[model samples]
Target: MTAAARLLDDVCHLTAQSLNRLETSEHFRVVKMLGEGSYGKVVLAVHNQSASASVCPGSPMALKFFPRATTSLCSFLREYNLSLRFCTHPSLSRALGIAYLTPSHYVFAQQAGLFGDLYDFIVPEAGVEEDRCQRVVSQLSGALSHLHSLGFVHRDVKPENVFLCDAACRWVKLGDFGMAKARGTKVPEVWYRSPYCTPEAETARGDGDGAGERSEPEEKKRGPRVWASVEPSVDSWALGVLTYAMLTGAHPWPQTSSDCGAYLKYLHWFRTAKSPEEELDLWAEPQHQGPDGTPADFGAKEQPSVAPQFARFTPLGRAFFRLLLNPGPADRGRPEDALGYLGGAWVPVGERERLEERRKKSRGGGGGGAVNEVKLKDGRGLR
Candidate 1:
């Protein structure tokens, strides 16, 4: 038997004594692998127990298995605690149960996203319809806001981590809490962050904001505490990027890194909007016009207002997105602020059908799940 087959076979024969020191339930029939990540793999499963006490009978679930040898139990516990802590929120994927099968792996079950993730649903050069985008952004806004309120920040927020509960995206949830950390904790290494989602850390030179390795003077500085702490605002920045990406099927900038010219250009534009030397202009926002010739104002601040990448959104949407993507951590208002822009269209309604058609085509483009199709001795693929 292959090493993979033997490991799973060992798991299949789990008994009550096989349950390590963790809250666990009955055995499960592994159907097929759903996906895998750096830490472990997730498989689709259903309860195999005949006992009347089964919480779910035939319903499918996503079972995440972390091999003990490759993953630390403390990491597993952290993710589980955080996931269960936020499970009550409607916009978060619920944790079904958890188990530590003696020798093979530590496993946990979560409600599955059968339709796939938003990454699969999004198309390049053209994004989801405005109505659908509105629904998704609103849900994520709520989810992020809830997380922040609980003093945590979801360090990763991108299309791939956002799961679709349905094809039309009427219901979506923020999943994959492995990178999540409490506010005020030391931020993870830059290499661990999701590109374009997390803000680029200030360089050692202290180029932009001036509080790093070389301050006003290295001597005057008490110490070179360069790395930043985790802030709840990161989720808002990521949400804004995700919003614009989903609307235009492209990123506003490649990423917020100093190395990228696109990001540098965007950074300059963002700074210009906040420049005190520049004169303020009160321009009428698009789609906010009343019956009269005058525009109805919703009190949005003045921004550069002419980003080619964000042209897909209306002036109103751009204004809100600017607020969300603001580089200044203290100023990047709450994700709940997106609620105010929820009533209006994010993108033009005329392009809805075209966007939907693109989404449909992308969904049908089949590249199967990330399963390693290894089979057992019986030739039944390890079920």
Candidate 2:
């Protein structure tokens, strides 16, 4: 069997064990279903058995079940690869446990996170203060800066993908790495498909359609391989759409055939060959408009009024947006580079003093449970 296939088989075996552990062990209890999406359902689970006895000591966890369909299997593999690559980040969601239930189904258990997605926390379905919006943006900026630094592209970076810990709104974690990918790979996931996808990339050609529907001259030269290519800038472009969405609660681009298509159009219209500074003007235009046709008053000139909440960002934040939303990959910064900008200003002086104090004061502190490892059929351990 291929290595990937064997790994899948091994995961399937371990998934059964994980489920059994939950059923019998006192640590994690499956309470109820939190939410479900095309990828998997999240459950409200907690650790019933912990050393510390604190009120509501246990938190909720998301249990993602992967189906065995050809498409879902691919997604399952991608999520696993991504989790292993970037799970070390404290701000990013941790992959606590992974197990496969069937050839087509796997259960991924993670820490029961804080409140629901960021959408609920940001603009209340009812109403919210504008100050609250600023707080959300700042926290998200920090999280995004972290992910971007790890060479990780969160392809589906929408408000809905962010989860909150409490109403204080201090802790924000990025979720749905189902669409995330390493920088060099073919763009991962439908959400990040290049806005420039040719017809072949967007539309699946059936055997009934015949082969002659292909039209690109490049396709003829490349002999069928050049038809639909997914690109890396695709994620950066998607980042622009996401930033616009969090600010306005709606996609900046038109409602079109696909998010990718709308994004591509947005890019073509505003990003053509503009420098990063020029692209900010494009980002500002949408922010400047009111719900109605009139432009918003920024108190100064006719410049787009940035949400007052975004005011605290240093030049690094602006630089990050410029790098992240750069029209071309050549200008855009890598995820790690962007992260460096976020932490660049903070100097960790007296770190040894801090560690010495921590060590002296805290002798025994509680940490999270151990992450169980699953061995692949080939004897590789998935930790």
Candidate 3:
């Protein structure tokens, strides 16, 4: 049997409630793997005891299991504690309890996002409909604001890390706290560093592309070696990127940090003063052209003189992007600023209703949304 199988066999029958009492961790009747990542795997589990079950209401809880070999005790504790500290907020997944079945297995239960993560909803290239995107921005922005107020920053904030609570995206939660760090603490550069969204690069520390070393026992090579202060601005920048991505299928820039042309173009679009070298670089970059020699990608028809990237979003969307992706770390606005745009036409009501129609067909469906007939795998839900 595999390590996971051993773990399941060991704890599937226990009714314990806390970490020290693994032998009594409830009798988990069913366990189905939901997703897996480098850190560990998340499984949807249901204990026989309903009232004592993790309060997911009508659904089973998600138990993310980490093996001792992969997740260090220190790392696990930090993530667990931080998650619980912010559990009071509706957008942050609550850590119900923890258990240590063996040196090889450690597990923690939390509210499950049965509808699946936000990445599933994003339509590649075209992006999500406006109202859907707006809903996500609203919930996640609030979550980030709450975390920042606590002086902690979720260094990694991308769509893949966000879980949806409903089909129309009216409710969502930002998951994966493993990369979250307290501001001012020098942490391994675990954030996505691409031209599309280089919040840390815009800051002084990561600007030079200095990689930091990981002090872990092994596999410390996941991110760049350069360590820098984890600030709230990093999350803000990520929100900007997420917003842009959800609004427009394409990223603002490519992934490489060495692309001078991409960075120059972005800077120009942002209206930041470029240095002499940057100006020269922007000048040297040639315009994209088609076989007929006309401009390959024209800017928005409404604003012919603007950058093509600006064509991706509406005027309101652009303003929201700018607010979250200010030039400097401290210059960025709070995530709550997104709440202001919630009433705007991120997507028209007519189209948003149509989008809602399609979401009803989703297999995973969602909670309390247009997806009225929530058909979960375990056949558990409200009629």
Name the top lDDT candidate.
Answer: 1
Cα-based lDDT for every prediction:
0.63, 0.45, 0.60
Every model's TM-score: 0.73, 0.53, 0.70
- Measured with C-alpha atoms, the lDDT of residue 129 in candidate 3 is 73
Residue-by-residue lDDT tens digits, candidate 2, 168-206: 556766777775654445421221122222222334322
lDDT order of candidates, top first: 1, 3, 2
- What are the per-residue Cα lDDT tens digits for candidate 1 across 132-179? 888998899888888777777787787767888898888998998877
How many Å off is the CA of 310 in candidate 3? Answer: 1.7
Q: Which candidate comes out best when scored by TM-score?
A: 1
TM-score of 2: 0.53
Model 3's TM-score against the true structure: 0.70
Q: What is the per-residue lDDT of model 3 for residues 1-383, given as tens digits with 9 covering 90 to 100?
A: 23322332344334233455353245564457788766778888875554444453445778777777876665676666567545567888777754455556677777788888766666544466776787788888888888777677787777667787888887788988877766677754432345334545533333333334335642344333555676778787778877776765446655424445655565566674333234224235565643433335533233443345654443455567667766667777778866775666543344345444554444244422211122222221111
Candidate 1 Cα RMSD after full superposition onto the native fold (Å): 11.1
